[model samples]
Target: MKADRIVSVIFILIALVFWSQTFGLQYNCSIFPHLILIFLILSSAIMFAQTFFAKDIKREHLSGKDLKYIIISIAIVFVWIYMLDFLGFIVSSVICLSILTLILDQKRPMPVRTLSSVAIYTLMVLVFWFIFHKFLLVPLPTGYLI
Candidate 1:
């Protein structure tokens, strides 16, 4: 079995499991998990299709720096998820976005980086505030400061 095929199979299996679990959960309760399930399934389908249908299967070697970036990205996301509730979405997200942008855009101008981080964080906060507070009527997370 080729590496790409193996990864594709694993993704398909995981997607199936997530899809099943989504159905097993109580209906009309939490929509977030369901949306995540759909995303997983869709992504898996794309991966599987790409692996099977694409003619080229030549594996490209990941440079050390590329691997480091990938690992850091995953770590940042994990930390963001863990800190979201405790730190509140705004603070946790701002930190995550700032750090990620800095890591990914090291060569960019300082002003550009700062403005981009502030804009991204502000947009995320506004979106979450609008969706949770206004649309869904769910209470926004109030951190220790609040």
Candidate 2:
């Protein structure tokens, strides 16, 4: 049981759990989730299968700094989700995406670069907002900011 196999197996189990829960959803509501879950299961299954045939399996150990980064990123994601209802999708997404970009970025944070990064994230969020809220007629979580 290599790392890839273990991760794929875990994803498959998680997908199975979500798949079961989708049964209670309305047909229309469940369709997207089902499609995504099916994709997850298929990809994980393929990865699991590939793990066996993969040669020269090099297991890289996570350093303390990398582990810290992972923990921080996960915490940021949780905070972003929690903020969505209060700050709305656009505000929360832009803020969180900016933070994530700053954290993951290794380059020196110049003023123009940081601003551009934020602008890019804002544009991306707005595009998604328009697609889901306007184009698809799907109501997104709205708050004071949006």
Q: List the candidate 2 regions with Cα displacement exceeding 4 Å.
A: 1-3, 6-34
Alpha carbon lDDT of residue 84, candidate 2? 90
Lowest summed lDDT over 10 consecutive residues: which window, candidate 2? 51-60
Question: Tens digits of per-residue lDDT for model 2 on 31-84?
Answer: 999999999999999999988887856678999999999999999999999999
**Per-residue lDDT over 1-146 for candidate 1, one digit per residue giving the tens place of the 0 to 100 score:** 25666786777688677667776667775477777767876776677677767787567799999999999999999998888778887778778888888888758659866887779787887798889878989987767542
Task: Give the lDDT of residue 65 in candidate 2.
Answer: 93
Pairs of colliding residues, candidate 2: none
Per-candidate Cα RMSD to the true structure, in Å, reads 3.7, 3.0
| lDDT of model 1, residue 135 | 98
TM-score of every prediction relative to native: 0.65, 0.75
Candidate 2 TM-score versus the reference: 0.75
lDDT of 1 at 123: 89
